[model samples]
Target chain A: MSIFEIIGAVFLLIGSIFLFLGGLGIFRMPDVYNRLQAGTKATTLGGMSLILGVGFLMVETNWAWMVKAIIIVIFIAFSNPISSHALARAMYKRKRYPIITSKDENMDAYREVNENEKKEEDA
Target chain B: MRKFLVILILAVLGFYLFEAFSGLGLGFPRFEHGVKDYYLDKTVSELHVANTVTSIVVSFRGFDTLGEVTVLFLAVSALGSVLYKRRHDVGSRSILFASSGIVRSGSKLLFPAIILLGVYIFIHGHLTPGGGFQGGAIIATGFLLMLLAYENFRVSHHVLSYVESLAGIIFVVIGLLGFIDGGTFLQNFLPSGILNELFSGGVIGIIYVMVGFKVAAELTGLIYSVLHEKD
Candidate 1:
């Protein structure tokens, strides 16, 4: 095997490991927030790595494969975080809090903002 | 008497269905010298559309496309009617929970790219795998991203409806013009230029563009109508 193929195989191995870990993370995480965090971050990197490994292996055929892989990676970079954020925000809005509270008093700033909006409307 | 009549009608239908279906050999369809062959043969040479699928969809079986578009239009209208409220009856609509600034800015950043991708897909429909429906769905998804991420981002009903109606009308007008000229609905009346060029597919390309526009507008309108229903 060529050096590039070896490198690609190694990347694939790493990506597979990360993907397996990501699945495990989602399974093991206690709550929605932690699961979302584990799922998005790990899967994003795992998928990117897997795709990039494929891209490297496919370099002999055409550079277009590499370009597509990069594009998907970029899309993952954009969409993964956004979707996770939206879901977390939705969950937070629905009052599904983390199992343990952080020691921050301003964590519930939404309540204050909502109250302020109500007060302004009232005024 | 009614039960007997129903049984007779069903028996007749079953016989007809069985007769029609049994003629064709059941395995992998051997498309030997039939409509598929004719479509495949004529699409490139006669229609000058590289994509046989595009030619069939936009030229040969274009009435089906019109009917499909009409069905989509009806569905959108149904959804709108179902979720509609008088502007005065309801308070101003906004996302109950405002998404973060990251989402807002990120969506704003990605919106134009998504739109450009959709437009590119539809415009290149005659040359590529994607056509009106796929592109329009992509465009609608982009609008959906905007709808989900922002508070005040509402697609105007008036403008969307106008665009949708105009697109549908133009598509029909094109079909009528072709029929009047060539004695066939959606006939290739215009000069079918050399295949694989931008303007090669003539009326086919135009129809697909119109279909894309109509679908995008209808889907966006459908999503918009639903978005407000949360209140």
Candidate 2:
């Protein structure tokens, strides 16, 4: 209806697109860790955008609602990364190895470094 | 044969549920005058509260709420008893997993903020959508975060029980005081102050505050007992 409304709608559209892509990534990603990475990044940005758009829409009408929206956005930003990290750490502790392809030489190098660290600890 | 019977029963149940749900109207009836009108019309003038839901929960249906709180208290006590361990064993129990320094520090920072938000929600229950139950749950969640991040985090059982008992006693005493003024149980005996003000709504706000404290302490204690159970 208005310029602010139009901007808010655009943000909502972008956020929905990111959320859709994040869902797609979850289904397409090779393993738990990769999926977690894709899912968390896209969803966090998507959710923040959506909340920000809501704040924009309410900016003129209600300052309190806008402030509440910003608080929610801040909470999501702080909690999302911590939760993702916890999930990844739990998976690692469980020894759930990611699917590795022969082309990924980096995995081998990472394993070698881990082994070296274990040996140092043992000695 | 067993599989076939199970499927048959589920199919019948699903069909019955679908039929029952479809028979119900989706919108409010145009020609019905019911208790809804009474509550909507009288809640503001009678209770001097802006929120009809609070008036209903704390004043009109106070007895039901008391029963519900009692049920919750019983359930939590049962859970605690089931999860109980020998007193000496609790001190020696080791945490199964330890979170990283980042998580621990972040949770420590966020914990107080979360509790403050929860308190705000409960305190503003009459003015807003949130109430004692929601706020108490949020407070419990803050405690849960502490439990998960810090192995040494502990809540004293004595403190929790005292808070829970005191809140419950205060709530009942307030209800009893209503009788002194020839009012029904939990009746608004005190002057319902001007609407929408923090001190308005008289007994409603006080009861909700008591409920908030009771629920927060109960849930936190329940969580603590469950978490401390011997593996």
Candidate that would win on TM-score: 2
**Shift in Å, residue A71, candidate 1:** 2.8
> What DockQ would candidate 2 receive versus the native complex?
0.56
DockQ of each: 0.55, 0.56
TM-score of chain A of 1: 0.82
CA lDDT of each prediction against the hidden true structure: 0.87, 0.85
> What is candidate 1's lDDT per residue for B26-144, written digit by digit as tens?
78767666798889888887888888898888877888999999999999988877777777777665545577888998898889989998999999999989999989999999999
Q: Candidate 2, chain A: TM-score? A: 0.81
Model 1 regions lying over 4 Å from their true place: A101-123, B1-27, B30-34, B86-88, B91-95
Displacement of the residue B2 alpha carbon in candidate 2, Å = 2.1
* Residue pairs with backbone overlap in model 2: none
lDDT string, candidate 1, A1-123, tens digits: 777777778878889998998899999999998998889888888988999899888877787998988987898888888888888878876768777578888877776776686699799
Model 2 captures what fraction of native contacts?
0.15
True contacts kept of each: 0.54, 0.15
